[model samples]
Target chain A: MKFGVVTFPGSNGDYDSYAAVRFAMKEKVEFLWHKSEDLQGCDAVILPGGFAHGDYLRAGAIARFSPIMKHVIKFAKSGGIVIGFCNGFQVLTESGLLPGALLRNNHLRFNSKFIYIRVERTDTPFTGVCRKGEVLKIPIAHGEGNYYNFESDVRKLEDNGQVLFRYADASGNASAAANPNGSINNIAGIVSAEGNVLGMMPHPERAVEDIIGSSDGLKVFESVLNYCISPKPVGRL
Target chain B: MTTTAKTKKVIVYVRLKDGVLDPQGVTIQKALGQMGYPDFVSVRSGKFFELEIDAGASDIDRQINEVCSKLLANPVIERFSVEKI
Candidate 1:
């Protein structure tokens, strides 16, 4: 399947995402400029990590208003596959495509390191290839990855199984110590209620090559491919 | 008679929701205590934006409110107040 990686003005991870899909997954991919509204008929779209608009006002706040986001938002509502990582995830939350907000890190420091995240669910398109409770070692780099939402909304997210991943230890235990940014309930990633959109803090694109560190991130792309070939009926199209 | 639109200055204050944790604020409060200001008790950090709007614009209040909610502050974790001053 073809994938589209969006490149905002300050996007530094766009090339990484493009390389991951083009080389690692052997899939067709293109860079979609933030000023362009066309998606180029891509089956899936990836909002790669970076300090878009210099993370002004707030992380991902200005990037959410990019011209291309209008089409991306529309595509997601139509059940298109969209995955956002790092600053991309922040944009998703800011755009209201996903619930909650990402705040400054609890420690008031920029964190950049490999962290373990347990796959909480495998039913969604983004995690179809992942085993439930499987822990993937991925790199997270951001100063504002602390996720937060109203207690009631968080409870609803949990009840709906919208939470797809959580910060976890090597043994897959979702504990406070494993929490990288003090996200509520150690939430590392989550999918929309419709299950077509996903937002995560970790940099899966940066983990696709074993030479760099680990190849576990390849599963995320593979899972999207698997879903495209045989999409299961979702609640809403 | 033709009248030109006048620019009106407005300020918007954005703060983290009451129940939301503010790590920066906490860190500042800690630093204050270490700096010999023990009676400070607590601190909350926030930001404000000054906007220049056209006074003759229709539905000025609604527009300002919309911008404040949609861009100035994230409603999920932030609260915003607008002032005409």
Candidate 2:
């Protein structure tokens, strides 16, 4: 399946995402400029990490107004697969494609480190390759990765199985020490109610190869690719 | 007939909603307490924006509201108040 990686102004990780797809995964990939209002017939789209639009007013706030986002919004509404990583996740929330908001870290410090995230559910395309409660070592680099939502919305997300990944220890326990950003409920990643879109703070693209450290991040991309190649029936015909 | 449009200033104040955690505010409070200002109860951090728009802009209220909701503040975690002066 072909993948489209968005390149918003100031997006530094677009190349990393493109490289991961083209070289590491050996898949067809294209770069979608922020001003282009086209998807280019790609199967899935990736909004990579970085301070888009210099993260001026707020992270992802200005980037949301990019012309390409209009197409992205429509694509996601039609059940298209979209993954927003780090700053991209902030964009997803700012665009109202995802729920909740990312806030300043509780410690008010920028954290850049390798962390563990336990797969909360393996049903969605993003986490299909992960075993139940499996932990993957990924690196997170952000200052406003703390996720906040109303109590009711949080409960709704939990009930709907929208909570996809949580900060966890090496043993898969959701502990405070494992949560580098102080996100509510230790949430590191989550999906929309329909499970078509995913927003996460961790940078999986950075951990796609064993030479760097671990290849666990590859599972996420592979899962999406496999799903796209062999889609399941949504309902009786 | 001729018409002249005047520029007006709009101020928008944005703050985290009740119960939302404010780490920056907490740190400032800590510093204040350590600096011998223990009587202060609490501190909350917020932001404001000053917008200069033409007074004759169509639907000025609606436009300002849209700006607040779409760009100035995130509705999920923040609440904003806009005032014209």
Candidate 3:
């Protein structure tokens, strides 16, 4: 199947993401520019990370209005596979494609580190390869990476199983230091109501290659390809 | 002859609490520090703004509160209040 990786003006991970998908799944991947209204005959869309629009207004505020995002929204609404990382996650939230918002790091500083994410659920295409409580070491790079939302929203996420990843220590215990930016409920990722749209603060592309030092991210792409290759029920995460 | 006094414009600003990272503000402050001699001790940042709504004394206060909550400030990590000065 053909995978579409969307590129915004300031995208830094478009190539990394494309290479990861192809290497991990041997899938035909294409680059869709932010201005393109069409996704160019692709089955899935990946919104990679970077400082789009220099993150001027808000992290994902400006890019959410990009033309390509319009198509992305349409694509996801029609049961298409959509995954966003870091800034891409910000865009998803800003577009209202997902719930919650990413505020600045609670420590009031930029964070660049490898954070272990304890998988809350792995039934979605994004995490299908892993089981519940599966641990992943993905790198996070952003000042506004703290995930925040209302208490009602948190309860809804818990009830609906929309929450996907939570920051954790090696022990898999949720703590403030492990939480990194003090995300509410230690959230590191989430998905939309339909479960097709997945957004996470960690960069799977950056983790796909062991050369950069980790391959835990490969499972996410692998799972997507696995679903496309075979037919499986998409589950909530 | 006396002219009606021009109504003074009051402005209010809002943003994240002190413990939050303001990346944009940091970048701007760094640029400022790089220009030449650096004497600015600390740089805390927030939004700048103005309001021109015409309403009763109580109504104006209520409208400001509404606007801040609805648009100006994100309730999650921000603390907001208004000033008339």
Each model's lDDT comes to 0.91, 0.91, 0.82
lDDT of model number 1? 0.91
- For each candidate in turn, the TM-score is 0.96, 0.96, 0.78
Compared with the true structure, what per-residue lDDT tens digits does model 3 show for residues B1-85?
1222343345767877775556667766777789863776557678866766543345667778887765566555577778775
Q: Across residues A1-237, which tens digit of lDDT does each residue of candidate 3 receive?
A: 889999988999889899887776577999999999999989889989998878875777788778898889999999898899998998888778888789878667888888899988877877778989988988998888888777788899989998888999987887887888878889999989888899998998889878887889887888888777774776744
Docking tier of model 3: it is incorrect
Residue pairs with backbone atoms closer than 3 Å in model 2 (clashes): none
Given candidate 2, what's the lDDT at residue A216?
83
Provide the lDDT at A114 for model 3. Answer: 86
CAPRI docking class of candidate 2: high
For candidate 2, the lDDT comes to 0.91
Clashes of each: 0, 0, 1
- Model 2: CA > 4 A from native: A233-237, B1-5
Comparison by TM-score, 2 against 3, better one: 2
Residue pairs with colliding backbones in model 1 are none
Predicted model with the maximum TM-score: 1
lDDT (tens digit, per residue) of candidate 2 on A1-237? 999999999999999899989999999999999999899999999999999999998899999999999999999999999999999999999999999999999898999988999998887888777799999999899999999899899999988888899999999999998889889899999998888899999999999999988778898999899889987532210
